[model samples]
Target: MNATATAAPKAKANATAPARGRPVLGRFPLPLRVLGYALVVGVGLVYLLPFALQLVTGFKTDPDAAAHPLGLVPTTPTTAAYQRLFGLSQAGDGVPFLRWLGNSTLVAVLVTAGRVLFDSMAGYALARLRFRGRSLLFGFVVGVMAVPGVALLIPKFLVLNSFGLFDTYTGMILPLMVDAAGIFIMKQFFESIPREVEEAARVDGAGVIRTFWSVVLPMARPALITLTILSFQGSWNEFTHFLVATQSGQYETLTTGLARFVSGGLGGGTQYPLKLAAALLATLPVAALFFCFQRYFVQGANSGAVKE
Candidate 1:
């Protein structure tokens, strides 16, 4: 009887014990932890290797790059590629680097601004407004997102040609100004905000436009930043759309200019140094933006996780 009583108390104690958590890396056996670290390092190196090679190749001479394709050290470093890009040398090359840069900058800026304004307006309306066919409109937006961009290339070309917008900045920027995905992103984010906030704004005699512009937009900084980054990156790197929309060399952006240069359009033979240098310069702006606004990007990603 004493043994049975003692066993019962022990069982109750076991039942009341807190559950053990999963084992952390530090708690693992030393060899397993070492293996995990090695795996992570290997993956990191794999990603960094290409960038390292690109940086080194950009400084290499054309012959050196061809001779040592995989080498991370330039045999003879030269600034000739950069010099050509900036028009300090080879003035007759006809690459029009400055013009390409200007075009890209103009289009990217306009597209980003337009997406931010128009996408946010549409998103807010869909999220907060009581309008006819609201569900149907949202469904259409979602459907547009599902359509592959490549499939619309022919149709976009036709539309531009019909409107006489072909080979113009308007054609390039207008087609990209408001992306369906951006609208969806803004809509989802706006919906996550408290409805009571809008009610209070209304109670204070604020109209729809005033409430959206003055009250809610300020609180949507994370989502707005996310959309801005996406818009900038997408429009900056856009190649296929520009290809279909514009035919003139005068309208060529960085992507088209780079493509032509690489394909011997300006009379150079496998100029890896020049190509890599241009690519590196093109990548810098996006990289800088990402690093600067990484925190807001993370917050935007996590915004949809919680309801209120």
Candidate 2:
């Protein structure tokens, strides 16, 4: 009987060994794996080519950029474009690059703060509080997420105009203070927290406000960081809304100002180097931010995917 039992286990192992060694759907042969890696690398290069070109072009002179638009190596590498962007060059006299940068920074900061605060509060309320029409309100939020933003442009413009918020910082920041996606993300994450935690807080003499503020909110760092990064990036990159919201050049953020700069509002010629330099600078902040908090961003994204 002992020998029979040992033979039976050996037979099972031998059966499974063949299956393990054989190639499955994703487990290709060595040659195919190498080919797959090469394919992925090729695709990555295709996506990165444009950014590489943009960086190289920013250092090229106008004539160089015009002559060699696709060149990865600059004929005469120069800091002229960057100098112009920073107002260090006399040729950059008319460009209010500093003003655009300031406006973008201010708006992005305010909008991010507002969204983090308001979105979290709204999400927590929807997730925890037992209130009338809760389902309806959540459904409405989901509906808002489905609605295309472009479709609301006209209505947003009319509302801003009606409320005398047009051409003002308040109009730019207020409209974007609460985003449906942020609210949804926060609510989902909040719901994943165990109810017993909140009950424990209450037993410790914490009221609803105290519990939410000190107990629950602190545990939601990942979601808050995610929301902050998204809000900042969105507001920083926003152009169409700013274009419709404000007519004055004083209100121009980096995106709107860059659009004008590229369209000959600020420069006479193509000014490809200058334009690319400005764009590169504008992109740096968001890129840096994402790189810095990427781990938190990913964690927050997956936080609500499962509930225990």
Candidate 3:
């Protein structure tokens, strides 16, 4: 029985591949590769086309943009939109673009930090500690994750107002900090780890928090990095929460600020170039991060199938 239990995993791993067969990918013939390449390129073009349109339209003058929405080349590639955004080309009624950028950065950083710290703490307790109502708390978290965020707008507003945090930076950020999905991610990751690691740390006179912070968390770099990227992207692009959390223009972050700026209210007709430039600026940091930590993201993709 003991031998069978030990050999079971090895048997399955060996069973997954045939001992004497050609590689599945090698069986792809020349024509198949040509067809596959064609298919892949077609999909790639489909995705890139919209972005290409956005970039080209951003450089066009307002009149040219209205005339040629589908044109690949701008009729007049002017930097006037960018200059105006930077306060160099005269503000029509004064758009505080810099203030919006700062607000977004501050909120995203705080929200990311809060989710990482608080989510991990809750996850650790759920995964490893002995406590009353653990299952109930975990069930509640799962239920919370199931609740659609749109449904919470009114409720979140009421709670924030009750707590006197409405329209403050705290109001803009705090509600988004403790995400149920982030807590769930950390819990699954902690539970996947080998038990012996924590046992050895504890045997060497480390407490739970010490073991977690020093020993366990270091081993959880992949999961932590994945969580960090997700949290940052989610909170940064977030629109609805900010809409409900704050009422004043002073509290406007990039998503909220840009939405108002572009949605036919802030002057002339369609300043597509200015709108797209501001969007590209807001998108760059998260795009850099997504590309940089791609391996961690890939690890997350397959994590659901991994068993301890």
Candidate 4:
């Protein structure tokens, strides 16, 4: 009886021992953990300080902004910058902020939609379709991704001029509609989906297009959402392409317009408040998109990381 009681207590202790040991395996000392947390917080503040300054500077007068560029609070807060951006100022010839916003929204939407469709289709073909030279075509796609975007600017400019697409909405959006990185991302994700799922669709008398559209595309929601977010963000913030693609003020996007406006386009003496206000507004849409779809984005990014 004594031996049995001792064995039971030993087993219970053994069981509880691992649970206790688990905590100590990768645990840091209390002081070290506190230091690590402090370090992380300090780094976070470093990254966020500039944005805070920009936000506060937008409310300051030009003289105030110049005087206290790094201040978090304005000595004299004003809404003149916001008023000017929205054309609420008495000046009838305010900056064409609405036109820039509209152009960015329209182009971002169109480019995002086109990328979602064409990139997915291209990725699907590369992943699932069997054909001659398929490997070579996919290799070409991957190679294109390695090519520097800046290198293509002059070529893109020449092509747009030749095709009469320069200075048009089509010119601004067409070149950005399909991206190699987007195609690569979609291909990697599509390859991770089960072939049996596609086989069942085919067994149900579905053609290639029907199967891809109805069955596969629905299951690719995470990747599609990720692609949509990236495409919209890229096109919205795109400047170099828009710079060379169009020559007219009518084709100006938020990025291009803001660049010109901040760089003395309006012939100003350091309009810091107006410049910072416009940049802050331009950053909001992309920030909102990523936060909303953050979960799906993480899942999509890790889609092909492990195999079943």
Q: Which number leads on lDDT?
A: 2
lDDT of 3 by residue, 259-284 (tens): 88888657777777788877877888
Q: By summed lDDT, which 10 consecutive residues of candidate 3 come out lowest?
A: 17-26
Model 4's alpha-carbon lDDT is: 0.91
lDDT computed for candidate 2? 0.92
Error of 1 at 222 (Å): 0.6
The superposed Cα distance between candidate 3 and the true structure at residue 71, in angstroms, equals 1.6
How far does residue 38 in candidate 2 sit from its true spot (Å)?
2.0
Model 2 spans with C-alpha error above 4 angstroms: 1-27, 92-94
> 147 in model 4: Cα distance from truth in Å?
1.0
TM-score of the candidate numbered 3? 0.89
How close is every model to the real structure, measured as TM-score? 0.90, 0.89, 0.89, 0.91
List residue ranges in candidate 4 displaced over 4 A.
1-26
Please give the range of 10 consecutive residues that has the lowest summed lDDT in model 2.
21-30
Question: Per-residue CA lDDT of candidate 2, range 77-155, in tens?
Answer: 9988888777788754646788999999999999999999999999999999999999999999999999998999999
Model 1 residue 194 distance off true place after TM-score fit, in angstroms: 0.6
Cα lDDT, model 4, residue 259: 88
Instruction: List the candidate 3 regions with Cα displacement exceeding 4 Å.
Output: 1-26, 91-94, 303-305
